[model samples]
Target: MGQQGRSRTNGQGGPGAVDGFFEYARERQLIKLRRDAGESPPFTGDPVLRAYRFCNVFREDDRTTAWFRQNVRDVLRESPTEVTLATITFRWFNRIEVGEQILDILLEDGWNAKRIRSRLRNVQPLVTGAYMVKTPPGMSKLEGIIWCMKHINRRSLPQMPMTSLELAHQWLTQYPYLGDFMAYEVITDLRHTFQLQDATDIMTWANPGPGAARGCEWITGHKYNRHSKTDRVAMMNVMRELLRLANSDEAFLWPEDWPRWEMREVEHTLCEYDKYMRAVNGQSLKRRFDASHQGEERT
Candidate 1:
């Protein structure tokens, strides 16, 4: 793990408010689903949702993730390790086009940090705002990243034993540049692609980041700890409970055409729900959505 990984989870909501949280997730998902079907602007009449940007209900539906599948994952499907390496490389930058450039360097016949630096030298702000990568003092972020990539490619990560999601997360986080948060993110992508079979068998394994922890807390009306292994397991239980409620609820009918929700997707949406609730409560948000951003999909 590098620099940004562990953090204290803090928030509380009424146990009775689970219904409200469910409603928000349901409506937010509906808006995205409708917009995807070629609907006009103002996807929702709810002012907060309309004005603010939130991630899609399913992580796979995110635009960059779609690009990842086509441009990176499929390109290297023969080797699971290569797919994982490209996935990490793509996600490290989080920009579809720019990620491809970096990935080319990664897949080159020779490993060269200088080449990586040259391609990204003039590129101001190489990373997307979705995730931040921090390096040690005096060492440039580019150099740190190159070193990290070299280690990942050369290490035995592909050969590592992954008996469960928690163990996969643990082994992956042991590498540089992969924090608690990013390890789970990469592993989720890997599992969704069916790379980590043994790990995905455990249905209740969803690692919580700070945002997901807040979301789980919001739904359960209790404090959730992202650090504790026990709490990580419990967090998914809350997700399952909410999912069960959604299946039985009359107000929110999940579209049959849509893919079934997975623990990973639910965990991701929970973070977006946390952001949505934050906006509803009048808290400041980092991203804004307006008419200019319409028709453009983002991850």
Candidate 2:
């Protein structure tokens, strides 16, 4: 979406919303910190955070992601192809039930797309709203997904490249129906896996997803072009700069133990913060996870 494409929803959508990034970020982490420490219902004093949902500042800390790591990551560590296969397939749906079903098949039956299709066909909510899944004509979303999963080679595969998000994206987009945004999602998750531990790029470079892009627009006060490589780099620079400031500035109040933000953390936080700003303004952002709710949030 371009500058004209995204409008501030209400009175709160002015300079204040844009500038509240750090404070909002700090409060969010503190909210989770207190909640995890077993503090009561109100994890945050901020009304928007208390009532609505936002993902953790870090993706791995999100429940669905933790499930992925526990179930799929360790299981597939020895098999590079399996990591790629499972990560890509699980992320396509981004649903714990679906991921659980996939894990069962991958570890037991070994890539049974037919069973996956059958099980998901009658399921009320087949996939999470996290990623867009647009199937080709005449194919259900499951059918398109099964077709892609089948094409995943179980044999030795190409060398896993730990280069940049741009390159990983190029390779991942080769999967059927995995477009720019969705492929970017896969790439982010992969960075957390044992397979991509050497992935140096993700630490400093991240593909600015839509929410993050819009968030960057607010921060930079510049119209963002989601597809423009130049625009992505500009956003990357801004996020890195924020990470630097958040860690260095004592005036920037945050949890004492709040780990310094990486580029991906910065990216993830910006995206959620955008939804937060909009939600507080009375516009509905995609509701996912919260202190009381268990869910896989959206784009």
Candidate 3:
């Protein structure tokens, strides 16, 4: 059956039908609210006032729900399709009503079916909870990207100015289980979104010793000693470039609309990093043991 027919038969129907149901439900709720207040519905065309009414009807006394409904529209407004897809993927999928609103707005704003399809690919993978309960095959790539982005945390690395290349190399070196693909994705995001440059500068800055003072201060908080003039100058140059890239208006931030997903991805990334570090330390111990045994045999 065609989508419209299938949707109708399955009770999913058209957007208009769904919208009508919500409108009716909202009207009934407002009627009850007005009756309780001993007055008719207050008339107001102000966008904020209308938003407040919608929040009151749909969210009731739930602070989180109200906050989401209030700010979600702003988050979606004028945001790129990729960003919007990411946001939706991060938010719990049970909130289909919100998703519909976003889709409707996008459609109204002249977004084509192809654009929607592209977005769906980027958004689908990041979905968790009930939304991801029984995902179908042939889902779009946008969905997968969203899925990964939602789950991947690029910030578990020490709050230092390590470039993406450095972070990936360190992660792979320390954790044998962290494959090239995973490291690449994490590192790329750190570079493009988090403004990390590359590995060499990161390693130089992170050098830990009594004489090590030249590095990104945001992470190391140590100024380059003047005595090491060359090192100090190089560190300063790298730091300046890092700051320039990160401080730009185009730099990415976890959107306020995606608090849940942002937290989940970050937490997961940190856990993985910690696990990798422990595994590396275990390998080091094994190597030491092997070396000692070989030395004894030689003696």
Alpha carbon lDDT of each predicted model? 0.67, 0.69, 0.32
Candidate 3 C-alpha error for residue 270, in Å:
45
Candidate 2 residues 89-177, lDDT tens each?
77767788777656787565546777887767876577777667766678777887787777666663345566566687777777567
lDDT tens digits, residue span 144-233, model 1: 777777777545756655567777778888777678777776777677544675564445667767888989877677788877878877
Reference-based lDDT, residue 296, model 1? 34
Worst 10 residues of 2 by lDDT: 1-10
TM-score of 2: 0.84
Which of 2 and 3 is the better model by lDDT?
A: 2
Q: Which runs of model 3 end up more than 4 angstroms from their true locations? A: 1-27, 35-66, 93-132, 135-299
The model with the greatest lDDT is: 2
Predicted structure 3: lDDT: 0.32
Model 3 over residues 1-299: C-alpha lDDT tens digits?
A: 12342233222223342222223223424433454566633422222222222212222223333333344433443433332333323243324443553455333432333554545544443332221322224644344333433343334334433443545445532433233333433343333222343345432322121111211221233444534757556544543443333233443322223222221122222222222222322322122222111111100
Q: Is candidate 2 or candidate 3 better by TM-score?
A: 2
> What is the alpha-carbon lDDT for the whole of candidate 2?
0.69
How big is the positional error of residue 252 in model 3, measured in Å on the Cα after superposition? 49
